[model samples]
Target chain A: MKRNPAALFFVAAVVAAMLFVGFHSARRAGSGNSDSLDVTGKPAPDFTLDSLDGKKIQLSSYKGQAVLLNFWATWCGPCKIEMPWFVDLQKEYGPQGLQIVGVAMDDASKDEIAKFVKEMGVNYTILLGKEAVGQEYGGVNVLPTTFFIDRDGKIVAREFGLQSRSLFVDNIKKSLSQGRAVQAQK
Target chain B: MQLMPRSKSQLAGVLLLFAASALAQSPGKKSPSVTLAPIDPVSVTRGKGAEVSLHFRVAAGFHINSNTPKSEFLIPTALKMDAPTDVALTKTSYPAGKDMTFPFAPDEPLNVYTGDFTISMMVRPLHTVQPGKYAVHGDLKYQACDNAACYPPKHLPVEFEVKVLKNATPAGRNPAQSPHAHR
Candidate 1:
């Protein structure tokens, strides 16, 4: 039996290359879901729930508009801090096809949340979210889990904590600009 | 039976490779050594003027958030006090926190605490108290994670002793020691 040094080098190179490709491809494939829910570059999971105004709203109904869906509770300090920014966003971009939705996660009765909403003067479309919706949006383990959806109804970005206005704006402007292109194509 | 020559070194090499990979994927390999300070068990004096204070010293770059966690999924730090039937415990308070985020995943960030944060428990002296060493125990529940992965929450049990004097100096806490004293 003869051992060839060149053959050993070639085999080693091939093995290293395979390992790199396998590791990176697996990592990329794993990014579509966060905490076992579809939240990135996928059609968001649709749910029908009662809006604060007593109207039944299904996520699939807002297919042509960019949606900023936020999960928050009144008692959460971080959520309270970001509520004003969301209200401002609704006023500024409501006409631009940007819809900001707040899904209250508090266990308090609707009357309690309505009182707080009135005190805070929140102007966006707020609704109540059950534990099921939290599971659908990747187990929103934190208050103020907000998702940015493109006009075509695909979630593009998500923020897990208090929303930063600048960061939120950047994501919104990018999505809106891209949405215009998407609309022009249709 | 014919004995064929086999390379013992090759078999040993294969075994070593398997062992190395298994160790790399073990659960305990990702955490640093966390040491909890000793729980000093003591009893308070039985008198109308008895008071107690519990103290904790978190290691650098480690902190536990207030009872109301800054975000969901993150465990909030807690303080539980056990004393005689006559003693009264004061409500606890936590200092403010700087907004910060941790990497729950490569692309997702979770709000959490960083750096040194402190929690304190105060017990007021009822006019009538028993003269004994009052023992109190509690844990600092926190999960330490950097910009990368988060380790499981660790409950660091911490305790302290408080002595009651006939005319205690109001137990004025050290400015450098108390959580409120820091700011």
Candidate 2:
């Protein structure tokens, strides 16, 4: 039996179309993975705001130290739950050059936030952030977006929701170790 | 393009392939569903304060954090009240929400709402108040997500009517009186 050239052409066309579709979808998936907020090896965004107290806190001011910048609001539930862990993290790492900064995105008055902060016994620096500033850093599209910045100001990791204490610690350790390795190389 | 017709089997084969692809990308495929609950109406006596709660119901496997959301990318719920100048608006407190992590996106975790949540606000009357049904509107913006993907920011408008009594003291206080005043 003789082979039909037209049938062979049709088969080849179908094969090529399927391969193209598969390749395109895979490429899209890969790009999405890399586009999360500058999680690793990028300079953290700098911000300055007054704490619940009258004092001022600046992200860049904490040079030579690792900083955990946590964006939250008084009305967020998970934020309240994470407050104690944040305080604990500060106590455990403050001496080791770790700064934990809390930025509040509340629509309520500052006094209301202060009351909540006082009730929670939050000792870290708390700053007030507007929606514009929140959008500048990405914005509180969701609650409890946490960024881990290293001593060199590079954002090492980021968590968009309520993050576990262990996950936070592990990421910080990894970033610190990486920093040391880079220093040794230098 | 050809006047020559193919066999019935060939047409069926082509139709079958198209059907398979359609099934793969069909809307009925496993997707997380989200729904919002209406805000309840609250009433207060004259010259007094009335507290009412805003409700949100999230589907399973999806959750949103309370007001103090962690990331700028995360959706933070908000309440906007439309009231007369005579009505005082107090701050609302959100109950603590669950800490939710998108399992597939192991790197980024957002504190979000998964199930039902509420926001309670204290509405007060001014010294000189009128009697009527005042509407309190709340725009709760939130980003919902399941284990794999996050939905776009949802603006849920929750409104309730509260009756103000005669000779009632306005319950809403001046936002300037608080430290976290947004105005």
Candidate 3:
């Protein structure tokens, strides 16, 4: 066998770099609250947050229905793109036990958020978000992070950033199909 | 020599591996970011004002709202300076924001700044201020977005050094002694 020390050394260096990258990627994917974090098929973390109308709203209260928990901010432009779609979808799917809840993750005042919601004509429930609550779901580092929860309260899927309206419809359908059908409470 | 082709092939293999590694590691493209350029040292005579311009650059494929956005709901990019007692930022002039339509709101034009932009500020040191170098610090608050998504508002720390020169002639200079100069 011909001894090629340079070639062997180069191959070893490349392999080491590849291993390092793989390890780094795995660590990143396990920690962040965005696309890297995989919370699918896991129980949705429940929390109590203040609704827009000075009332305490709890996530677990809406049981036996498919839930779309959206983390959005008033300053998020892409989030605005999805707002009307959400309103329409809520009207279309409300009878089918689908509930869309928007968690306003912003530093804006409650009144400001409510005003924006009113201007957008949002029909869904909006809850003021806290950093601790965001931490529970890994960390809402990105705007418009959405979780699709089934009737069993398991997160069917998680989407980060603005996605197409059709994609949202598909996830909603999947979520509604798995959860038990129960009459929605006002 | 027979080994020349072999050496070239080996080099090509290494280059390909490095290029592939870079491609896999580049994820910042998805994130929006803005950066401030290092400010040039500004020298102002005590009791006089000097114009200092701050240059900021936005990452490719991103834009930040101007000081006056069309919508009140939007967070405008603004600079807030905290200067020493001796120093004051009297005025900050923002460049007029260009009206641009994005895929998100195509019908409604929004005022925004993209790529390189500058914010000019007037820096003045009181006449009583000692002639020396002072660091003026501030923060730039901006909300950035791309064609598809928007990021939360971020504050970038900004700083610049101002050299205050003596407003009057040095006392060391012997005044031309006119016999009745004071009279």
Candidate 4:
């Protein structure tokens, strides 16, 4: 029996292509959950959590305003450094449709977080962060990770670790400008 | 019937292709997230002080915070050594960190270490100590972070053996060269 060399080569090439495609698709499917949440230009994941004052706050309620969502903990050193900056930004940009929300990813008691908030004079809304909510936001593993969302609830940028006050202000300005553009379009 | 040389060559070719693909898919092909490789140990005379160096590597795209954090509250990378009674740790020296600016903090520069770095320590033996082999344990504590997020603080344990020898000459005379001297 004679085997055609051309046929063997074609079969090998097809097998290689199929294997490559299968590997690529498997990798994508494995990371789909986190990728969908963290990808830029996608709508931010919405959740409802109780504020420090026992007010049920829905993320979608602030859709028309630019939002800065910060996931932090009381024990995190970087969180302490940026809490003051958040307070200042809330004061400066609140009138311009900026809403800074802090989700405390802490195991500390509510009184501890409240005391820290009072001491820092945080002017923004503070909510207790749940592990499930953190997972939904693609795992807030780092302390002081922040997401900048535009007025349309689309995440524009994500920041990790301790960020400078100027950087936060710059992001806020960008988000606010995006809000104006979105309003004009509506 | 016996197989022809061409048929044997074809089988060899197919095996070679499979081997290449398997090598490509192996996890060892990827760089490790973090690693601490122990360098050659140091030898010292009793009551004399000496230094030991260790190589530390952090994967690309990730950085560990520096010993001197930008803020007071941030967790700083620290190296702690557990020395035996005979072996005393005089001091530990850390290399200067690279100043990096990320998009999160474009203006303020943070001190961090990426890629490969070295941590060295000065150790001295007590005067009453005898010549022997001693194991020194150490822990490197750090918090790793990338552009997207930060991970919890991790403590990596490392150890290296030190061989202490008795002085051959008088107390004031020059000591002999170490046989295990690192290049």
Off by over 4 Å in 1: A1-38, A53-56, A75-82, A107-112, A162-167, A173-185, B1-38, B44-52, B57-183
Candidate 3 lDDT over A1-186, as tens digits, reads 354678667777876776676556545433112433467888899999999998999999887889999999998887898999999999999899899999999999999999999999999999999988888887777777889998889899887778789989999999988854532432
Worst 10 residues of 4 chain B by lDDT: B23-32
Task: Report the C-alpha displacement of residue B45, candidate 2, in angstroms.
Answer: 30
Better structure of 1 and 4 per DockQ = 4
Q: What is the interface RMSD of candidate 1, in Å?
A: 9.2
Query: Residue A116 deviation, candidate 4, in Å?
Result: 8.7
Candidate 2 runs further than 4 Å off: A1-36, A178-186, B1-154, B157-183
Which of candidates 3 and 4 is the stronger one according to lDDT? 3
Which CAPRI category fits model 3?
Answer: acceptable
Error (Å) of candidate 3 at residue B91 is 1.6
lDDT of candidate 4 over B1-183, digit per residue (tens): 244567657756775676555433432222125679955777877787888887899977678878887754456788988998879887789888889876555676788889998888877887778888889987898776655345667788978888787883446643344434644
For model 2, how does the per-residue alpha-carbon lDDT over A102-181 read when each residue is reduced to its tens digit?
88877667888888888889988889876765665654455567778877788787776565679889876755555553
Off by over 4 Å in 3: A1-36, A179-186, B1-30, B169-183
DockQ (0 to 1) for model 2:
0.05
True contacts kept of 3: 0.31
Tell me, by lDDT, which candidate is best: 3
**A9-52: candidate 4 lDDT, tens digit per residue:** 86577558756754664454321012224546678889999899
Computed on C-alpha atoms, the DockQ of candidate 4 is 0.09
Candidate number achieving the greatest DockQ relative to the actual structure: 3
Question: In model 3, what is the error at residue B3, expressed in angstroms?
Answer: 24
lDDT of 3 at B67: 98
